[model samples]
Target: MTASTDLLATFVARYPAQPATAFWRGIEIEQLARAFASDGVGLDLGCGDGILTDILFKRIGVTPRLIGVDIDPLETEAAAAYSFYDRIHTIPAQAIPEPDASIDYVISNSVLEHIPDLEGVIAEVGRLLKPGGRFYFTVPAPGFHRNLRGSILPGVSRERYLADLDKRLAHFHYLSAADWRAMSARHGLALDSATGYLDGKETRRWEHLSRMTGGLLHSLSFGKSRPIEIQRALRIRDLQNRMALPAPVASGIAKMIACPDAPDSDDIQSCLLVTGHRPRD
Candidate 1:
């Protein structure tokens, strides 16, 4: 197996039940079912494990000619397990295997943030879609915290938080709601609808503290008893407690004043669900 395929296989092995992955897949399937109820071809870009593809097939019942593409052969192999798809293609995001304007609708869920060349991928999406075709996709909004810092402080440097963001440029890109609108407009696409959510600083801090505490606990149990690790363990636990203590007390107060139009409480950040269409002649 190639190195790329091997790495993805290891990832799947470690987190076979990727809850976040399943959540995004369900979201995509629901959106697609509502938009395209009839039989029509669709493409699932970066179709890891084919969970979303399976959901689309079962829910839509359109028997739409499905094509799933991924760079990782292992993921492609996993995707192939879903017999519903008419074909499974493995190729880089910059260069899809299919010809231009080949599909009716394109579903890109949580895939753009990882791509380094955002413009290139957007152009490719344009190429793949028929005139007036719909593109339903979601990207990570700015201010996404993955528990790197012990707490979410005001004015955190974007550079530090997204240090690895550059590495996955080929796979994703982080953009704000306004930025996404401008991008789609530039690419000759019109926005249909959008949604946003609030990612309060407190909630982010709590998540960070939880991860740090978990990591420190694992290291202390397994790693050497270095002085640094000892200090870090104590520090992480303290931060965890400080950030987690007042969540319940403040929950009621937050609800009374929270924005009504904001996305469901379950949403992690200010995500914008955008549906764009290519203008017809």
Candidate 2:
């Protein structure tokens, strides 16, 4: 994958069930691939379904000794189907079943924001990492809700819409770059870098695509109280996933939805990539 088009196509093929998510992940997955190594023992914190890790490792062309963990049994069960993770555990983020300083690295993709007790998880990461081991995570910036493109309909409240959307997405935290740095330091991890991605334009595009693809189901399922079950029971997810397209066709669709603006300005970003490392001392 030389350009964004190739990365987007990969996600489009794997995540046929959620084209919007694919569009979003297309950018995130690429950013993530460049931020880490392809070897060593890594723990996928909150590894939902394992598609992201699988695609990420494929992009890197190396499969490390990877372990996946999730609080939800259903998600862990689904993640077990993928060969990316050597082991899958259904456990709380605060309580991973691993020895202290045993892991070489820890990665959590878009999972930290949904966690209410983020401090506990970060502390766990510090404890689990072999000193000098890194912790890589992605979360929405404070601008996430502000960057959204809500309904243009008359009498539509953007605040109301965004709040509802956040609830539906189960987002609990929208931390600033500085906030992440401070949190990392508190957990004995030095903040290495914090970069922004998913600009305002692309965030808006994602919102549009999500509404077009999963709006009805979200409404019917009462803000996705049981989105997986609903999608499975209706066979909507199965049908969507089954329609994976060839690379060329997927690329074409991705190009159409691709956002041209780059996330150069930090203030306008909808998401952030934060990396920190434990001190070797």
Which candidate gets the maximum lDDT versus the true structure? 2
State the lDDT of candidate 1 residue by residue for 1-281, as single tens digits: 01122222222222222322322333334554555532467788888766555545556565557788787775677678676667888887777888887778887766777666888778788788888788877665654544224324476576643543233223255576678778878877777766543244433432343334433443455544432245345564234222332434334323332223433344445344567777775
- Which stretch of 10 consecutive residues in model 1 shows the poorest summed lDDT? 1-10
Model 1, 83: alpha-carbon shift in Å? 1.9
* Root-mean-square deviation per candidate: 12.0, 2.5
- Flag regions of model 1 displaced more than 4 Å: 1-16, 19-39, 56-63, 143-172, 197-269
- Score candidate 2 by TM-score against the native: 0.91
For 1-281, candidate 2 gives per-residue lDDT tens digits of 11378888888877766788888888887888898863588999989877778788888778667889899886677778777678988988998889999999998999999899999999999999998898889889888887887876688798888877877778899998899989988988999888888887788788988887665567777775544566678776556544567888888887877776664354578888898899999
What are the clash counts of all predictions, listed in order?
12, 0
Give the Å error, residue 51, model 1.
1.6
Ten contiguous residues minimizing lDDT sum, candidate 2:
236-245
